[model samples]
Target: MKLHAGSNILLNLLVAVAVSLVVNFSYLLLLLVDQKNDPAPPPPPEEVLRKAERLQCGALHVSPDGHGYLLYSGGDSIYVPMQRIRRLGLRDGDSLVAEVSVTHVPLAHPVMGKVLRRNGAEFDYGSLFKRPAESVVLTLQLIYYVLISFILLSILTPVRFRYSRRRFIVRCVWCLVAAAGLYFVALVTEWRTGRLVFNFMTPRMLDYVLLLKCSFAVVVSMLYGWVYVLIMQQQAVAMENEQLKNEYLTTRYNMLVGQINPHFFFNSLNSLSMLVREKHHDKALTYIDQLSYTFRYIIQNGQNTLIPLGEELDFIQAYGYLFKIRYADKLFFDVDVPEEFRTWLLPALSLQPLVGNAVKHNAITTVRPLHIAIRVRDGYLEVANPKAPKLETEPSTGIGLENLRSRVHLITGREIVVVDTDTEFIVRVPLQNPAL
Candidate 1:
């Protein structure tokens, strides 16, 4: 929410000026037209006495007439028409409620003057300045100043000055200082010229004080609003950046482990070489097809955060075809995937590595064929293989299992698990939905 100091200063200035102008313009219309000097005039003692008699008569009488009624409270009496009181939405006496009525005096009185001639409803400044128009103008100007001040301060504070309490306070002080400057300029100009600037003072002084005050008020309000909005925008951008950073690190780890397990690669290559050496050219081409399929699936889908569990299982089935062809009657696989789990997601190549591990590590022959199974249940993909370790002397890199686990963890924030029982080695990988 922190705002640039220069911008904050400019904004406060603009807001102060705008508020001042609005106040000046409203007073110009409502109060300034009648402001003037006038000679002395006489009083109306008789009408005042009649109104007082009406108040007292209504106060003592049970009912003045069907058309009017009286109310008395705290040694004061008021007389009002029954219709008017009803129109005011009053019932009985409700002390907490306020009642208001407006009374207007005629701009011209036939009895007071030499019957002043008029053109298009000309305003009367009134005798001896009895109307006190300057007071009305000053009240309006004060109200305008207050409204502008509140708006400017609200906008400039808090969100804009988020960095430090002191900075926010400083920004507010500047706005008030600008207001005080306007007040002083007006007060001093009045003292010198015998009139406030906006109240028809000379054009030069009027332009200077009015323009500066109004412009400052408007600019300050806009700056505060702009700073607050921009601060929120920056915060959202920062959060997005943090999220992307975490995703990048996760993707990098997945990529490093996603490289095909070297042992599996070499073993498949060795199997293909043996097929060709035995002059089984067609079957070697079939093994080549299986090898190509495995690599292509990984390369194409590895960048994907989620692939359908069905797709990974399909790749496993294709790899199983190659293993069965190589071991002939000595390799078998069973699939137990539920229809519901088909569309559920796992990390790309998540299942293939576990099946590859079973094929590479287990012993299989015509008399003792290896058995592998793939199943989906309870939001997990379960791959179980017969525990028939064949290459006791072979060193294990453990890269394939670790790669699967890393991918799962990166995408789902859940663990990939391996379990071995007396007869079966099982891997369970948690499933998820794609980002879409």
Candidate 2:
């Protein structure tokens, strides 16, 4: 599963912290070994130590009242008299380490004991160079490792995996190269600073140690990145599948709508031919004009999946005019859709098929006139007609009803409700709000 953005960030931070702790812990262990192997020399004379203590060899801080100094040790603070101190060049919060006398006598002065060994924050470049205190070294190491881990995670985590063997191999090689390059840079920095940053290994074994460390860091980073990439790829595949499904539905709807146009065209021409043969030239001309207007509406909206209810109703008026011209007073449509619901959208060409179906299956005469009602009620656009099915009529293919159902469901996500009884046949189409 894909992780939330905040979760991912937190996880990455945890990984960096873990890596930094491990690296710094290992370095501290190595530093202990180095100290054991290379011991410090013997202490200086008592007079010299006393003079050094008075000179403030360690970091010095003036008391808040400015009457005394506070010398900071690794885990302790030593109070010293301000008057006794001399040549003290230290500042507040500066890192320093000092060795003081382990005395048997109780002192009267604020000086804990005379300073024997002293080290400062300055970098020593001599042959027997002095190193910074353990606390400073460890803190720097932790900061360096945490920064490196964060950089590696940011660089690697967003890379998408390509499913090719050659690309995979290339990526592995690139990671190795990058790791080696970073290791080399670290080595150069440590050498320039004359600091033994990592394990105190012999020159012959140091290369292997650095390589192993770098390789482990790179591998962990790549593994984290690969897991993220897998989740992202899965989401991408799902999105593509959804898009293809929608496209298939669109194409299928267009095919259904395409079927309606040809069927409607043939029927309209038949009606037009009847009007021409009956010696009603003026009526036939008007029928042709109405037919053109209806066809124009269909052609303009044929590719659309949904259109406003008012627009479809206007198209229906033009279509119904052609049929009225043919049947005279025998066919009629009663539309009572409210003005408020006119802006609601519905599947294109939805109503015309139902009207055509009713006319196709019913018998229209002056005595038993056909009445189709189009109205809105309870969030539905209902097209209902009085049942007058003929006994001798062309066989019903049932494509029109099926097409209407599929198109309505695909576009509006609602089914067209059909009700058939002895007296009436009704289709309740669910209305849709395009703005919503």
**Best-fitting candidate, measured by TM-score?**
2
Q: Give the Å shift of residue 408 in candidate 2.
A: 0.8
Q: Score each candidate by Cα lDDT.
A: 0.61, 0.72
lDDT of model number 1: 0.61
Query: What's every prediction's RMSD, in angstroms?
Result: 15.6, 11.5
* TM-score for each model: 0.55, 0.69
| Candidate 2 lDDT (Cα, 0 to 1) | 0.72
lDDT of 1 by residue, 91-176 (tens): 34322111223345565211111111122122243531233346754765666665666556554544333444465556666766
* Per-residue lDDT of 175 in model 2: 62
What would the per-residue lDDT of candidate 2 be over residues 1-436, giving only the tens digit for each residue?
Answer: 4556677667777887787777567778887788789866554434444665533344656666544444553644566545433324334554333434344568633453433334533323332334456666677757766666666765555344454445545665666676655665553124443555444333433466556656667777778767656666787788789899988987998899889989999999999889878889999888888898988988899889788999999999999998898788999999999998999998888889999999899999999999999999898999999988787987999999999998888887889899999999999999987678
For residue 268, give model 2's deviation from the true position in Å: 0.8
